[model samples]
Target: MARPTVFLIQIFAIFGFLHLGFGAPISLENPLLRQELDKVGELPGQNFVVNFTHYSGYVTVNEDSGRALFYWFFEAVEDSSDKPLVLWLNGGPGCSSIAFGEAIEIGPLLINADGKSLRWNPYSWNEVANVLFLDSPVGVGFSYSNTSSDLMNNGDKRTAEDSLVFLLKWLERFPQFKGRDFYITGESYGGHYIPQLSQAIVRNNLLSKEKSINLKGYMVGNALFDDHYDHVGVFEFLWSTGLISDQTFKQLNQVCANQSFVHPSESCDEVLEMVDKEIGNIDPYSIFTPPCSDLSSNRLRSRMHRIGRVGERYDPCTEKHAVAYFNLPEVQQALHVDPKYAPSKWDTCSDFVNLNWKDSAGSVLDIYRELIQAGLRIWVFSGDTDSILPITSTRYSIDALNLPVIGHWRAWYDNDQVGGWIQEYEGLNLVSVRGAGHEVPLHKPKQALQLIKAFLAGNALPALQLHSDT
Candidate 1:
């Protein structure tokens, strides 16, 4: 059993910005801060030694609604200032980027299997760039709203608007990053979040050149590109992969063909029930991997299973650990989380936020088209094992874009092994992480790092072997 680390640290004025002993200079003059800033002195069950700095705090996005979005910042392991800043968001329309993106996936630390301690991850993206993980929209993770109504009225428009506000105010707190090269990345529904947020950033930069975010481009993985094609691709993947029966696939195509995957009709639901039977006990997130022990209940037999479970190498159970550690009073106190604002318990994804999510758009394809036209680096990646949002789904949407293939498809390598496959379109890139699941980083960290490195550098994925130098 792992125990929380107990330590004494300097406390700045309550909720006012407090430096976490990072050598970074602070002006403290930024009026955007209302309460004292919160800093994580140490996390509970973190026994591994680390040299990089981490901070946890809230930025008030809506003062009247008391809506504050929580964020955790990790400076790069090397010369921190020179590195580009990357903002990561996890999609649920309501998931905690901190809990999923940071703690369990590509962040510097990994929660131990005991669900009580921490370990360092060699593949943390922060090794190459400064990373910020945010739990956005009110009522998700440590992010909260004083007004109850705020929780029930969330959609892509509001989320994008509030997130843009959070970014502006956050920059005010850490002014050093004001003109730094900035990039946004996310996964799953993040396919929706990243584009919408990027659109806002682009518009803001155009409106006022003086106070513009140095927006570069964005990448989304295992994302929901378009509802119609996602529906089409999922059924195609299921049938083609032999995960579903011929009859079941045919019926699903006919019954649920023209419905929203997020909220399908009764007929669609029934067809999906047949899909459930065909999928049987397989993990929907990573069809070939064994699901965590907690997922074997008969109650989940025929329901849509979210892509969250532990693998043999990476503990899918890390979510449970994060909830326990973050909810600890001592840990919360050290992070400057005011008890009143914190949830009764932290969750990886919020049902309240998802339930109230008002999806107004049918497809973000138009947004992709706009961003591609804006000359921003756009990359879309998919984990081959994700059944819910399979690679086939991604291909369908990409094909719809009708972009000419600039770089023909080729297998990319990592550590002299086939990492995945990649193909560059005229303005975009589509990648598939071979043998990886819905959460690519969680299952294949090294390859995920390779993918990001290539994306950030605007270079093609490394070829397996350069042809003979004749």
Candidate 2:
């Protein structure tokens, strides 16, 4: 199963990544806006220079529930009007896409350590197409609900329904994007979100001929496939990678077998604790990279960094920087966040939403099958190093679908060097970012950009480009 690349995957994910710092937000003198621009504006301390424009605010998904979902939109670097629209959701079932997607992962800028500045991310997805980062499910990030019960009641089914409604209502605000080619992308738990929302869009498109979203396809990375496979892959990866002892791995499998991974039993938790201890003080998200060693600076805001590595060059301190930047009063006001929710600090992941998530479909394989049959451009990519939902686990789950190989497995390249590996199946495509963690784009921006661009263009990963050195 292994294919040799010119360079090791771990080195690319670590020393090869880029690291940037924050600058003050430049106030837009005459910020351009579409006719429906409500909270159209620039960040107060966003000092990075850019040609494209961005808009942010809320869309009420449910009036009776009084729940509003917040969103931040960035136009493409150039010719944004003609570019396709991509919706990005970060999975926590409760994490803020704004906190993760926008601030740290694929968004336009990475927050500075000062917590009051912004820096340009050269590989931001907005470079290719219009990108929308949504803080979904009422209580995540800047989104909230007046009806307290709505916060307590979020699940896969509800999130899918609300997201569909959010998309429809959001279109009303920017009707120009209504008929545009649209795609949804997310990670981790978003595996659930992408499929369910894509399925909803398909049903909606069939229902209404006049007002429908022109959804093209979707991509999910390092996603939760299903409980059994996810757990199996998690343990297997640890054992295979030599992170855990053979005894610990065997005990975990035996005791945790047929048990809930989400809410594991006492014995299972104990076994996991042993597994965690065996793995030791390394970042499980990206095992080879150095874990964030600084915690005292901003404990509350740093939680997001706990699960994964930070931006280019793998700045171990990005979590603290993001926490500081997002918590600034000026930044909050600039984003048009309601003051009522200010007392509660911004979080990368939501404890309430994660704990209260009401539903989890056993496996999205069925949904994948249905969507592939529907002829949607389905793509699944994985960060080869993610232990939580390892590439091995994802491979097992996708293999269950038995998709016929359209293109044989081969190494794909970027900048004329091997970036990762790709295998195209009849209805879907699977690509692996050699050294990335749970957040593929954060660690391997160049490769991730290439992956998304090919997916959006409905083409295969670019063939190896010849060079003088070669």
Candidate 3:
């Protein structure tokens, strides 16, 4: 394929996958639009030196519905062409990965305290892999739909289908990434997105005469998986950590047992609401971290509440900075956002999408089983300080798999200090990030970087030293 240096695309994702019929491409390419439109140079109020390549734009997944997913891609600091491609999504079932993943977690820079300025992130994930941040499922961040109806009717299956389609179209835009090793990564609700999308990719590859995505494996941290196990573990951690009284814990267990994360029983909701009042103004997602504000007492914003955007629920104030930065006309223009298509105001998460989330799998454990059997590199990590999707819950969820142990459980080290604990299973691995919260990278970026590097290399976390100053 010739490099059409003169053209950039507003990708209308015509191609389909995973139970959707494939459509022929339409001749709607705009040759006058240069790829420079997508290349992000210095951003508005950027104070740090720009050193590497990054681009932000949209990939239209449904032309008929005018639905497009926004993405931000960053090349590795060095030897970018050789690094594996890693796609990062943030869960919520409706959250903006740009807001959480790129703005604060692992993107090249952090939105500064001033809300409009930027500073360097020494621990950005792009240092290791060619990172891609996607605002998926339409109506997320800069991603939008001309058809308002599309926003209300989104679910796991369509999200996966649209995402796979987005990937297919996006690969066309940057043909250089064609066969590079790719991995899907996210957390919270991504317990469903990652596995389901991986299933779509695997099945799609099996169907393609020539293989498409060079999918190696994936990793998820502080993820949501089993409904029963996850729900049970959240309460147990609260009880063990003394966040809830023993009597309250017993009451919760009695009332909330068998309650689905998405649809709790009336008794369960009443008990949870009571417990929310019990926890007070502290962030449930990161128990030890001082919450930036007290906006969530009315309704616990954590997944413990009806909302699924657990990862960023605790981060009310921090996200405001991102929202301010991304919403700026200059910032959006710099990122090539078409104002006509973008929302009047940029938001970090969408309540409408969450409220209308049509389908959510109760457990991705079966998909996990299938992927593990397919020999995908699967690892699940947890932040020990998180009460929402606590490490205990992740352990219980993974334990339900009942796989044989390959590597014994032990402590892992980073910089002569205990970073976390780890255990390797026959087909999957589990890790617990010490002293970290729900958003592992936001709280412990150095450790998160080490974890990502290990995951990309398929190596275990660094072993503890024989003799250490403990």
Candidate 4:
């Protein structure tokens, strides 16, 4: 088993000035702000990094009851004003976007062999658009609150509300980017996060004419969109790939097709057991470990399992590494985490952070429908080899949408070499990354970058031939 890695927690300190009533206005003139501004420079892949100097001391969700906190990381090309801002979140219901920033997509540097210091990535996302990676809701990453209750109870509703407040505060901090286009993108559980946040943005847009956040589009990669389709797809994929025996496939098909079946019941136990065994045997790196050995029992006890242990507690304001490499003396000094490698436990996904607010009724497909109706562009891409949220599951999810196909499934190529396949439907597009796993950018950076570039440019993906079935 891969050694456990600590989840790095990153939080921004609110300071400078207060505008009161409306919210706190961060002063760019603060000394720490000045220091951060001075630290701004070119990161790997020629991307410009500006430690967002704005302060968000306190965000009040309501005058009487609701409130949350957040911090932002902004990256862009130097002196470029017309680019769009893309808000990126990482799923975990508790994972930090900073983790995604450092390990997979963008930021500035990568953790070296020593675990500390920076390395370069030539294909960072900031090359095309301004990116804002946030640690949000309240306790994930660097965001925090004095109220202990705030740390323990949060769900999708609270997440969406806090995210909206953060966006508003962000706009207030960087007024120049207010009128610019904004897009929400994330992976894994973020598949849920982006849509919920987008829906909230739309509602706010409709409610307030004077102040509207112009949300352009949203995308999810290897995201959990629809539970029913996603679950079924996993079974089909295992069978089709010859990972399961023909007899097992037949048995599973019959069980799934039965219309009388209901969730959280004992009748489905045998099928679920088969699934757990197959999944565990096939891919040991299940992002969220299965709750029980019996699949039916796991599904029925999903709520209990989902609320698994929250790891060691550390101050949100403190800089800690989720992985040992990040906490190395060299890393701490280089990354600017305090105490320089002082053996601190990392919480990549905090169990203490409440996510009970996510409407149990809401499915990934439900959010997708809302986005389509709201006229928001959507893209769902998958890394073919990812067992966690495989391409088959994504295709299955899209099929249920019954989205009208604008273009048939065809190959996407680079340098005349077959790269992957693309299927265009209305405002939504689905593409596969050849040879990529759960983390596409990390696995196939060039292909991933090409796809992102084409999507951002609003161009149809180029056609390449599909791999022949021998």
Question: Which candidate number has the best lDDT?
Answer: 3
Task: Please estimate how well model 4 matches the true structure, expressed as its whole-model Cα lDDT.
Answer: 0.59
Clashes in each model (backbone N, CA, C under 3 Å)? 9, 13, 0, 16
Global CA lDDT of candidate 1, please?
Answer: 0.80
Q: Lowest-scoring 10 consecutive residues by lDDT in candidate 2?
A: 26-35
Give per-residue lDDT, candidate 2, residue 112.
Answer: 73
- In candidate 1, what residue range of length 10 has the lowest lDDT sum? 1-10
Put down candidate 2 lDDT per residue, 267-288, tens digits, no spaces: 7777776776677777777778
The weakest ten consecutive residues by lDDT in model 3 span 12-21
Off by over 4 Å in 1: 1-36, 298-314, 465-470
Runs in model 3 lying further than 4 Å from the true structure: 1-34, 294-298, 301-316, 465-470
- Note each model's CA RMSD in angstroms: 5.0, 11.9, 5.7, 9.7
- Residues forming the 10-long window of minimal summed lDDT in candidate 4: 309-318
Q: After superposition, how far is residue 107 of candidate 3 from its true place, in Å?
A: 0.5
1-470 in candidate 1: lDDT tens per residue? 33112221123333334343555533345432221344455577777667877777888999998999988889899999999999998887678898889888899987776666778899999988999999978888899999999998888899999999999988877878889989999898888889999999998988886644898899999888787898799889889889999999889889876776556788888778778777777667777877666645532222232323333334545667777777778877767687889888777778777767776456899999999998899999998988878899899999999999999899888857888999999999999999998889998998999888988888888786555657
TM-score of each candidate structure, all chains considered together: 0.90, 0.88, 0.90, 0.73
Better of 2 and 3 by lDDT: 3
Tens-digit per-residue lDDT, 1-470, candidate 3: 33333122333222211111245433434211323447788888887776788988888899998999989999999899899999998878778888888888999888876788888889999999999999988877888898989998888899999999999888877778888999988788877788899999988988995556888898998888888898889889999998888888999888886777765778888788778777887778787766665345445634564333333433446776887898899998888898889788888887777778888888889988888877899989888988878898899999899999989999999967999999999999999989888888888888999999999998878896566568
In candidate 1, which residue pairs clash? Answer: 14-36, 15-35, 15-36, 15-37, 16-35, 16-36, 16-37, 17-37, 310-316
Query: How do all the candidates rank in terms of TM-score, highest first?
Result: 1, 3, 2, 4
